[model samples]
Target: MEKVTISAAAREGIGVKGALSKIRAEKKIPAVIYGGQKEPVSVTVSVKDLDKIVKAGKNTLVEMDLNGAKELALVKEIQYHAVTDNPIHADFQRVSMKDKMDVVVPLKLEGTPADVANYGAIIEHILREIEVRALVSAIPHEIVLDITPMTINKGLVAGDIKLPEGVELITDAEAPVVHLAIPKEEEAPAPAPAADAAAAQPESSSTKGKKDEEGNLTKDAAKK
Candidate 1:
């Protein structure tokens, strides 16, 4: 598990439209922290700073410093602007050190399958992520699928991967992660049209202006 630290400020007058608008204009995002058996708190954090943390993935663990009071949380949700696609609001769920939680971990394919290029094959990723339960400290940064030993027409499923100790798979073992593909054989070219006797005549550049010993064109040359 990767732990991170971010700072935030307890927001004042957040419910007011005027105050929320001002925060967005300043490039800050309004967020709420709930759970951990405490009343939800409204806070504001830098849009630029929090954006970096979320890019690490939703399962990332964060320790927020809200004006000296610390809280452990998972970024539960992020609302993005429909047009600009920028982060507008965020929701955090407070968690405890002892909690065994389910989080979605990203799946990464690690190697090239054997004979992929020679066979004109492709690797199609089916399940790009999986949910797992573990203590906050036991979550893996990613789920890795090693395909070096996989050959064309082969596949891997959730059962194929061995995870870090203390992590339990919540996804189905039979669910496929990736599979190698072989492209279909192309249809044979239509038999070339039967040769056209006239069209197959010798190239003109090679036979142009030929004449006989009498200085008269030969019968084949005269036909040009």
Candidate 2:
């Protein structure tokens, strides 16, 4: 697997919120390392360093250098500030190169399905990513599937996927990843005819009866 080198430093006495704010202000991102037998370590890294590493995708194997001490880790989770849209925090799980780990890999569609071009069928991607189990060093960044033969009502399922050696799919084999279907056109209901509208109107006799009841109530109230 391709590796990205990211530099980080052990945080000092500052609290997590304060340290995270300071890190963001310096154009750096705050992160934590967990998993294995060790306590989680809070660290900070450069934002530019992360942008380059994140391009390798979420399941990528990352080599983290913490003040010169190196370790192999994988991106587990990332937290982003809702308003600022900045990466506020992240989690990295340490792993051994020889051990198999479960991770989600992005799905890449290759080749235009024939139905989409020749039969006016719309192509829909039901799954954007899939989980797989593989060695940390053998984990793939993305899985590519061909859809050239797909036509209307046809689909490609997880079982049809061909993965690289040593990479086993953790997602359901029968789950559909992509589907081709004809576009649905909605038709508006027809307007009611004028005769039907006239026939449905409330009877004038009922209105007159209602008015008579009101008049009787007013007379009774006046007598009281």
Q: Which candidate number has the best lDDT?
A: 1
TM-score of 1: 0.79
Stretches > 4 Å off in candidate 2? 194-224
What is the alpha-carbon lDDT for the whole of candidate 1?
0.85
Name the regions of candidate 1 deviating beyond 4 angstroms. Answer: 55-57, 188-224
What RMSD value applies to candidate 1? 7.4
* CA shift of 126, model 1, Å: 0.5
Per residue, candidate 2 scores C-alpha lDDT tens digits across 83-159 of 97878788889989879998888999999976677878877999999999998888888888888877776688887
lDDT of 1 by residue, 28-89 (tens): 99999999899999999888768878777667889999999999998988999899998899
Q: What lDDT does each candidate get?
A: 0.85, 0.82
